[model samples]
Target: MSNLRVAIIGCGSIAQNRHLLEYEENKYVDIVAVCDIVEERAMVTAEAFGAKSYTDYEELFSKEEVDAVSVCLPNYLHAPVSIAALEAGAHVLCEKPMATSREEADQMIETAERNGKKLMIAHNQRFVASHEKARKLIAAGELGKIYSFRTTFGHGGPEGWSADGENSWFFKKDQAFIGAMGDLGVHKADLLRHVLGEEFVDVAGFIENNAKSEITVDDNAVCILRSESGIVGTLTASWAYNAGEDNSTVIYGEKGMLRLEDDPSYSLIAQYTSGETVKYELGQIQSNDEGGQTNTGVIDHFVEAIVEDKKPLIDGEEGKRSLEVILAALESGETRKITQLAK
Candidate 1:
């Protein structure tokens, strides 16, 4: 099979560390072009991938005969770029918090469907090895009747993660739309949905800008969420974890409880009601404090989905549903009331 020609739209940290490197390693892919508002970044990334460079995405779209494109731009640019690429007859792998609003997300999805193109949101946590294992166990009815859960994804701030550090678009409300809620919270929201195989019905959130004086968006947020089937949980997303990043989850079920990424040695630990304990040394979750991240298998899956003519694991609708949960959380926090999601 001929390799799919791919273009990367943002030459930032996510594109550099995740999308670009992964695509280069995938034998089924051939980098065709790279774009960024910063000419130097775009040129450097283009050189690394042996592809053409452009400062404007529209120019790249008009010029390159690409089979697929990765939209790694800021949150606000996600919908426009992805929709444009879909219109240009290429599949789009959009970075998550799919868009700033449900309206934007809905339009992107509609454009892809109208164009007969694929639209996959890059929710890499769903592809984690330990998460995959946990999902299978839950599906097999091992973690019987999940009663509650608490998940957290926190770090020092985007200053360490973004290419521009504290000055990145992530700190601007206009560009980022939401701060930790969009960056870290949405990830857990999506992961929980995938793991529990249920939809979030309502949420109550508390948000504040406890750190990072330069930004207009909140740096810390905590939320209580309930699933459609009555599973309750708390989600915390913060950029104030100045000590080190903590990416962990604990799920309590009638059978017992499961802890993920809570221990240094193991990635998953399960305790059954009958006193049977299983420790899975699958691997460790990547340490953002140490600038380490494991491959999330996003590129491979996106390519394979197109090549096999099948829908991606996280399609547009699935992404929209996950995004809705985050949006509702924001509304709940702003209104100071329990928010309900329409069935």
Candidate 2:
């Protein structure tokens, strides 16, 4: 198939590191346009990728013959931009914590369904090799009778990640809607759901902004999640881990325990009840320092799905379900009660 002509809205850190860089590596994709509210940001990114630059996404949509688009905007703009792209006859791969609200997420999914276009959420954690192996093992029932698990994704803060640094839209309640949970926690929530192949039916979250008190959004969140089968676990997302980042998960089951991203030398370690320990060296997790080779498997999958006329792995419905779990946790934190999610 010919290269999928693509446009990217919002030239933020994620757009630059994940979307733009990945598209550059994918031979099936051609970066047709880049958009950002900041003129210079758009111009620089466009020049680097040899694409047109636009300050307004609407203008890009109207003038470009795009086959797909990546909606990498701030949390608040995810829904409308994705809906518009799908309406404009473009498949959309939107950055995650899909939208600020379920209502907006529902609208995006509906628009894609109506337009017969693909809508995939860029939840890259699921594509991690170690995570993928763990998922396959769990699905094969190697760790039978899954009992509990704890997942965490923490770092210094978004101040180091976003293009705008401390003044980025990530710190704004109106723009981000939520903070650590939306940023780091949602990734774990989605990862857990994908690995366990179970939905979180209940959630209780303790949300706070202790690390960055100046911000309106939470900088630390400790969440308790319960799966449909009664398995329980804790998920913590924080910006206060001053020493370094911790993106790890430990799963306990009847036959064995599995640890992912918990060791610097090994990506996964499984301890079986038979006293056998297995180590999996799946390479380092993708980060800004890792450069462009940190392939997330996102762009490839999205491109293949569009070309092969198949649904994306993390399609709109799947993303919305993971999003619902995070939203439920936020609600639980606000109401100081265990929140129930739809079955």
CA lDDT of each prediction against the hidden true structure:
0.91, 0.92
lDDT of 2 by residue, 1-343 (tens): 6789999999988888888888999888999999999999999999999999999999999999999999998898999899989999999999989998889989998999999999999999999999999999999999999999999998888887779999988899999999989998999999999999999899999999888878999999999999999999999999888778899999999999999999999999999999999999988788644544677899999999999999998999999998998899889988999999999
lDDT of candidate 1 over 53-103, digit per residue (tens): 999999998888999999999999999999999999999999998998889
Candidate 1, residue 139: lDDT:
84
Q: Each prediction's Cα RMSD?
A: 1.0, 1.0
The C-alpha stretches of model 1 lying farther than 4 A from their native spots are 290-293
lDDT assessment of candidate 2: 0.92
Indicate the residue-level lDDT of 170 in model 2: 88
Could you tell me the TM-score of candidate 1? 0.98
